[model samples]
Target: MDVQILFVDDALFMRRVIRTALNECGFENLLEAADGDEAIRIYRESRPGIVLLDITMPGKSGLDVLDEIMKIDPEAVVIMCSAIGQEKTIEQAVRKGASDYITKPFKSTNLAGIIKKYL
Candidate 1:
């Protein structure tokens, strides 16, 4: 499919991993943002079909970005990424309008499955 997928994370490695995973699944239209600010900017311009966001970051946190993105596009399909034991933040992200949540150290295949279901 030609659906646009966006990855938002502060970690370069994590973003790279996500890219490779999506690539393996035959997804070629991928975008990336390293912080909440960049994520929001890219979201507006790219209007990606799905957004995979990291919960913690140096700048605007993912939760804030999620809220802002929802305001911009209520139907924005955002999936919050969290490390293990961050259930509280993940729950809050959901409440803030995240479409889904994925635990870190994820399998690319698993992420592709989620994207397929939503896309």
Candidate 2:
């Protein structure tokens, strides 16, 4: 099956940009959510092969979603995305269960390389 990925970001533009990059990089099954709560719901229902989550959001935070997912499945492969200078929060996310973290405004090749390593 095509590698499935669920991308969660509060910014619609960021989501679209990520979706486009993943699509162009051979990931055909991409799902997106605008917030962590929706991300949790989608993740529970779809159980995608991978997840790309943004750290800062309006509600329930990506870290919160990561916590929930880890509770449900310790083996879940999650990648945290954050802007520069959010080291503490990102580190907390890593401790919570994220397999990797990426910064915002990342190059498509960087994303593709990380995804390749994990998925």
Candidate 3:
């Protein structure tokens, strides 16, 4: 399959917003997971090229999902996205092997556009 990006967020609105931004950037191979468990399942089945993960959620926060994803594939490209003032959580995510972190309210251009080059 072609390279793809998975947007993992508890908020459906945030997922749609992120998807729209990616689409505007000319990316069409996108996927979504409203919660961590579904994220893991999809990751296993599809093995998307990248993951845009939100930190806060109802259960199994993005951090936890990142850990699980890393366990499944150590080379997984996971970018943690969190609201401002959550430096500690972001730091922890980085320490756990997240490829990058972005603060919320970010433009799609802020999402490591060059990342597509690597994929």
Candidate 4:
């Protein structure tokens, strides 16, 4: 509901930062998950319209979650977020049904642009 978005990251700071960026871009319905397992649980329950996943998390990792999400819904809209140097992981996520991959340290404009494309 309300253009739902779920954001998964082990770091609370990163979650807040991305949530804030999305809010600045006029997005309001945001959910937060601290790890991949929790992200998967929430995804099944809430069925958010969009998901933003961080690749390097505590357990299961983003790619693992992406696979799980794809299993649940082949058409799931997922955007993988990777750090500056994780090209392989990003590529793998894309191959596994992620809608796109966004390199970390991104500007609000860039993130917003990606979301707009999905919208």
Which pairs clash (backbone N, Cα, C closer than 3 Å) in model 3? none
TM values, all candidates = 0.97, 0.96, 0.93, 0.96
Q: Which residue pairs in candidate 1 have backbone atoms (N, alpha carbon, C) closer than 3 angstroms, thus clashing?
A: none
- Worst 10-residue stretch by lDDT in candidate 2? 19-28
Residue 46's lDDT within candidate 3 is: 92
The order by descending lDDT is 1, 4, 2, 3
In model 3, the Cα lDDT at residue 76 comes to: 92
Query: What lDDT tens digits, residue by residue, belong to model 3 across residues 1-119?
Result: 25798989999889988988888777789989999999999999999999989999888999899999999999999988999999999999999989988788988887746456457
Q: In every candidate, how many clashes are there?
A: 0, 0, 0, 0
Worst 10 residues of 1 by lDDT: 110-119
Off by over 4 Å in 4: none
Candidate 1: residue 37 Cα off by (Å): 0.8
Candidates, ranked, TM-score: 1, 4, 2, 3
Candidate 4 per-residue lDDT, tens place, 1-119, comes to 26899999999889989999999999999999999899999999999999999999876988899999999999999999999999988888888999987898999989999987887
As a whole number from 0 to 100, the lDDT of residue 10 in candidate 1 is: 98
Clashing pairs in 2: none
For candidate 1, write residues 1-119 as lDDT tens digits.
79999999999999999999999999999999999999999998989999999999987999889988999999999999999999999988888889999899899888988888896
Kindly report which residue stretches of model 3 are placed more than 4 angstroms away from their true locations once superposed: 112-114
The whole-model lDDT of each prediction reads 0.92, 0.91, 0.88, 0.91
